[model samples]
Structure formats: structure tokens, C-alpha cells
Target: MENYSKAVNLLTDADVIIVLAGNKMAKLEGLDLLGKGQFEQDFPKFAQKYDVHSIGDAFDQQISSWSEKWLFWSQLIEQYTNHYQPSEAMMNLLKIIGKKKYFVATSIFGHFFEQAGFNENRIFSVFGDWTLMRCSSGINHGTKDDRQVVQAFLAASKKGQNLADLVPQCSVCGQPMELNLPLNDHFYPDTDANTRFRWFLTGNEEENLVFLELGVDETSPQLFEPVIRLVQQFEPWHLIAADYPQADFPLDIQSKSAGLDADTATLIEQLDKNRDF
Candidate 1:
């Protein structure tokens, strides 16, 4: 835990905090897509019909009707995103960042950062958020907030109302709309957010910044090496990872990086302790 002190010092001295969060962070907040224990219990019909035993498998299996699809999506979005509460770790992260210029690049698509009070413009959800939907026509028709759709379906399902007509469709091409996830080849990312992330890096190229990697693993491989490359490229940009050991980094940048080999919650908890807010 000696490095916990190092992390605190970095946070205190940094002008910018760049968060690279991944699925392990999502798991800490209770949205485990690959979890085997809860899928059948939470979604019996999906288990029975498709023999899918996890959320990942359920999303992979095609539902026979749009009604089923939308209903399933509604339940998931409501549980994970719409009704999400910030975890203690998230609050601690906010406190550590402390109004400093920060940008989040995360593969967690549950709207956790935004719901936790991070500015939407500074966060990029790389895998796409389920709270947003897009046209399924393999063409970019823009994204829409799917909160209204989720609410409508939740209300109808409670009353046993028909959901066929309730399924959202593209306003332009009239095709069925789907969650803004990279579930298929047709998935389109939030370009505006991507642009903003790029701009943040460019603008802060020479500033004292900490690139904090939280619970990143193979699920979000894109976040790892590229960030290390950035640390190698920029002298003022230090790297910190919750799950990676400090010795794992390249020899040259190892002095500027700290790999804690800990989980997100533990790191944030450590960062939160004995810190002035």
C-alpha cells in the first residue's frame, strides 16, 4: 500500500485525470455481463428458450419477436443504467479528481460515470451505452436517448400490454432500432465523444496528467497499450493501473508509471482515505 501514497500524490499534483475504465470496473458496480449465477434466475425465459446462461449469451441469442427483444432490453437498461446509483469507489474517484480537468474513456456502457455526476461531454463510452439506441440499418442515422423507450416498455410490461408497437424504429429509414452497443458490424460509436477525447489529449499533451487505468483487462485491450504508448511519448503523463503491476510496464516508462495490481474499488478506497476534499 506504499504506492497508495504515490497515487495520492499524483492525483494531488496532476492538472488532469484521464480514466481508462473497463469491464472489471463494471463488475465492481454489479453489472457483470459474463456472470453465470444470475442470468437464469433473473431471466428465466431467455434461459429456457435460448439455453443462454449469461447476459452476454442472452444478448447474443436472437429473440424471436421485437416484443421480446424490447422487453428484455427495457428490463436490463432499467436495472443497470436508468436506476444505477454511484458506488463508493465512484464517489471517491470524483473526490480525487476534484474538479480538475478529467476525461473518461471506458468500455462500461451502463451510463455509470454520467449518473455518478461526471460531465457527459468529458466521458467516452467506447462499447456504447444501452441507454442510447441507434438505427439498425448498418448506416449511421445518429443516436437517441433510449430512456423514454425504456420507460414506456417498463410501464407496458407491468400492465401486460402488447409490446410489438412499442418497439422503437428508426425515424429516418423505418428499420428497427437497437441498443447503441457494438454488438454487430453495424454498430456505430458516439463520434462526438470520441472527438472530444482526442481533443482532450491534444490540449493536455504537455500538462501534468495522470492516466489512471481501472480494472482494465482483455475485454478492453484497446485501453492498455495505447495509453502506455502515450506515457512513453509524453514526459509529464504518468500511468497508473489498478490491475497491472508496476514491473509489467516497459523499462523506460516504468519510472513514470505505477501498476498497483489491485482492483478499482480498493484503489479508490485507498485514494479516498486521509485525503482533504
Candidate 2:
């Protein structure tokens, strides 16, 4: 009985459902979270000598933003798309979140979301797109000028090596380039991401938030705590948290701990049997 019937019932009652995404979602979307296989494939020379077991995680934990991660991965894609053919895998991941209203933190998946059909408004990307670039200068604070730099960066990335050698530079002010999230103390949230943050705070005004976190793990507390708070405040009848190797939840609800890297489609297929809507 714990199937689509109950899952859909929960969905119908939901007002402002949100998904605080994590790296698993990215991995599902063709980006390697551990920098294991493809990272090796992308740069076999480096992988051959050094252990990249934690390099990707370290970058996110250290010098890079979420967008920066994808941009880096895209560099990998540029290098190996013909040999790797990651498009289908990314496409599959995108299809899953395509219909859901969500907030993303600038993984490559964010771009795939757009490719998969999520509306611009429904998806609030907390980090500026890695697919996008702008000068890291504080001077271009708010202007049409920054977008021009962004466009130029995009255009240059088209030529291929630009992705390999692209260094960030301010258009007008000649500053270093920056990614869109708070990767460090020096990290600054961009204007759009700031606007999205404000919008996300108010996005739940309808106040019907159900978090359908498919693969969220414990790298960041920021994503997890708020949903728990929402669950407590509204007491949303039930919070259905399904994960592969699922984790614990509150006493009020039961979770479907499938296993790590569980087939999300199978879970959804089972959940949708009676979801008819």
C-alpha cells in the first residue's frame, strides 16, 4: 500500500514543493562527483600520477563554486564528448526533475534542467551558472556590461580551447573572473542568485512545501536543515524521503530507504502507479 497512491496524495496537498539538490543529482546528470572515472578520462595524464579520489570534492570544498564545477566538467565534456557520449545519461537525469519545481545550487544539472524543460522561474539556481562567466570585479556590481562579458565568455567557449584556456576578465574594469556561489569568504553571490535567494525565501508564501530530495547527502547542512524546519512548521502530513541507502527522518514519518544509487525511475514508476494525476 505504500506506493503511488500515497505519494500522489502527498503531492496533491503540497503547496510549494522544493528540492535542495546535491552532488548525486549531478552525478546522475553525467557529472562525476568523486572525479573518479571521467576525471581520469578527461585528464589521464594527471589521473595516472595523482589520486583524484577527492579532487572534485576538494575543489567544491575549497577554491570552486558549484558553477565552476560544471564549467570544469564541461571542459571534460569538450575533451571527451565523442569518446564518452555523456549526453544520454545527462538527458535521463534531466527528465526526472524536469517537471518538479526546484532550487538548484549551480551543478551542471541546472543547465540540463533548462534543457529538460523546467521553467526559468520554477528553478532557482542559487549559484550563477557555470555555463556562464563574468568578471570577478566588484566594480561591475550591477550593469548591462557584465552580461556582455558573460556573452563573450560563452562565445569564446564555443571555440573549444577557450574553455581550456579561458581566464576570467572584467569587460570594463579588467578584473579576474568569478563563479556564482560563496565558494569562500571572498565568494560573492551574484545579482540573479541573490534575487533567487530572496525569491526562494518568499517562494513558499503559498506555504505548501514538500521536499522530494532524491539523492541529497551530508556535504552541506544548508540544504537539509530548512526542509526539516518546513516539515515541522507545517507538519506536511508526511515527508516522503526516499534515497538509496536512505537516512533517518523525524518520528512523524517513515522513509523508503531503497539503497545508494537506487534507480529513481523505478521508484517513480512505483510511486506513479496510482498517481494518475
Model 2 has a clash total of: 6
Residue 63 of model 2 has an lDDT of 32
| Top candidate by lDDT | 1
Number of backbone collisions per candidate, in order? 0, 6
lDDT of 2 at 217: 62
Write one digit per residue (lDDT tens) for candidate 2, span 115-168. Answer: 554566656554444444444555444322233344444466566544434455
Off by over 4 Å in 2: 1-5, 46-74, 77-110, 136-168, 181-184, 190-194, 197-208, 235-238, 244-247, 252-265
Residue 120, model 2: lDDT of: 61
Candidate 2 global TM-score? 0.65
TM-score winner among the candidates? 1
Please give the lDDT score for candidate 2: 0.49
> For model 1, how does the per-residue alpha-carbon lDDT over 102-204 read when each residue is reduced to its tens digit?
9999999999999999999999999999989999899999999999999999999999898899999999999999988988998888889999999999999
Clashing pairs in 1: none
